[model samples]
Target: MFSIVGGHPALDLANTVAPRPPGAVEEEYLPDPEALVRWARLAGVIEADEPAEPSAAALADVLALRALIDPVLAGQQLDVLLRRWAAAIERSRLIPGPHGSATLHLGTDPALVIGDRLANALIDLVRNADLSRLRTCPLADGGCGWLFLDRSRNNSRRWCSMDDCGTHAKSRRLTERRRSRR
Candidate 1:
């Protein structure tokens, strides 16, 4: 299952690769072209009515774009990400939006559309988003290393989801306290 906790399309795409505990086999939600299309629809990168099915090479490009995103979110390897952004921009067009706005129109090629959209999204995030608000779920806190924008008033968010990782961490702490009291 895909979780859209990243708060951005690019980050959401990066999270398609599920994070796992140590010794557990890594889970990839986007294992095939169909899966990529499904996720793109869910992430609002593509429309539900869009009849886009990426080819194997296109899928590979999407996955590669995702790989580049994680490092940029972590504040490393930025030049590599910028290069990909340039390529995506080269293949895209700036089109008019309603209310005097503009939108980046992706090419019709299903193979490159998803990657181009993701790259553009990533660049938008880098330019407009508060990089300081970017936070990764801490693995030591029973998190799956998913990234999220911490928009909390206090900016103290530490888990991807309180119902999931936060509960695991709380239960662990309670058990430890009980044992230590014995």
Candidate 2:
């Protein structure tokens, strides 16, 4: 199952591929076409009414885009990803929403629809997000290298969820301390 805690779709998408400790291959959630559609749905990129099937080409495109996203979140070069994202933005159009604001819509093609929404999220990240607050979950538990935005007022949020990784880490630290005293 997918964990949708990244606060932003772009961050969530980047987290589909997680970091592993040394000597381990990175964990990948979007392994095949079906998994890709599942993640898109979970990320709210594809709606229930939308076509979410994935093809060979679409899966390749999604993985490639994720590759570009990972380094950007890590504070690396943006030129390559930016250019690709700009082209994707061109393929979408902003129209009046049912509400007073505007919403972006892509073409009817499923691949373009998914890719464009992802591109829009990435573009929004570059333009609107505070890079300082975007960071990996700080749990020392090696398996979960997920990224999230520290939307806290102090920008000090560390774990993906205090109920999950935070509790595990705290319990682990407590056990270690007790053992050392023994």
Candidate 3:
């Protein structure tokens, strides 16, 4: 299942690979080209009628792109990711839309179309999103393994959701505390 809590489609994609407990295999929601398309559709990045299947090369590119996104979200250097994103964006062309404003149009390549959409979302997030609100879920239960925009007034959100990671973490801590007292 895809985690859609990033508030941005790109961030959601970056979250596909989640942290795992020690000795546990890492969970990759986008394990292959078909999985990528399924996630893209689930995220509403592509329409149901549109093709979402990615080619092998495109799948590799998408995985590489996701790898670059992680560090950028963590406030790291942007050169590599920027260059990759630039190439993806280059695959698309901006043209006048029926509404009079420019619209990005992608070629028939399914993978290119998906990459372009994710690349645009990432660029927009970097340019317009509140960096201060970006946060990682801190639970040892691997949490939700997703990044989220903490729109809370205090910006103190620690888990992806109170019903999920938050509940798991609280229960874990309580269990730990009880064991310590015994």
Candidate 4:
């Protein structure tokens, strides 16, 4: 199962590996090409009619892209991110959308489609989004290092999800306060 907590598809891809505290084993949701296709569909990177089978190499590339983008999301690796973005752009095409707007059409190879879309989305975020609004769930605060765009009115969001990491952190704080009183 996948959690679509990240507002952007690229962030969601980065989050495919669940956040774990230090010394905890990482949980990877996309373990194979089939899992990647399923995730791409859930993330809206691939259409219902699009080809679903991806070559093994494409799956590796998608995994590699996920690795490359996660660091960039955390405010590191800009030059490397740019190179990957350029590569994605080179493989993509411009296509017409519903309201006469053009959309980037990442081709049919399932993993490549997801990879290219994620790359484009990351660049779009970099170019248009307020980088200050970007944040990582704090591992010490019961977060799993997932990245998210803080779209709150005051941009005060801290956890990946109010229902998940936020709840955990809040509960921990309450428990700590109770223990301190005892």
Best by TM-score: 1
Per-residue alpha-carbon lDDT of model 1 for 5-53, expressed as tens digits? 8888877876776573232438888889888888888899988887676
Q: lDDT per model, in order?
A: 0.79, 0.75, 0.75, 0.77
Task: Give me the overall lDDT of model 2.
Answer: 0.75
The TM-scores of all predictions, comma-separated, are 0.83, 0.82, 0.82, 0.81
Scanning candidate 4 in windows of ten residues, the lowest lDDT window is: 17-26
Residues forming the 10-long window of minimal summed lDDT in candidate 2:
17-26
- Per-residue lDDT, model 4, residue 52, is 63
lDDT of 4 by residue, 1-182 (tens): 34787788777887888773242647888888888888888888778778766678768878777777746756788887788778777877888888899976666344467677777787887788776787888987678888788889987888888888789889999999999999
Candidate 3 per-residue lDDT over residues 55-119, each given as its tens digit: 78767877777776767766675887677667766677788877779977754466577877777
Clashes of each: 0, 0, 0, 0
Model 2 lDDT per residue over 68-100, tens place: 776776667688677767777777778997768
Among residues 3 or more apart in sequence or in different chains, the pairs in candidate 2 whose N, CA or C atoms overlap within 3 Å are: none
Model 3 residue runs over 4 Å out of place are 20-25, 74-77, 98-100, 106-108, 139-145
Which of the two, 1 or 3, has more lDDT? 1
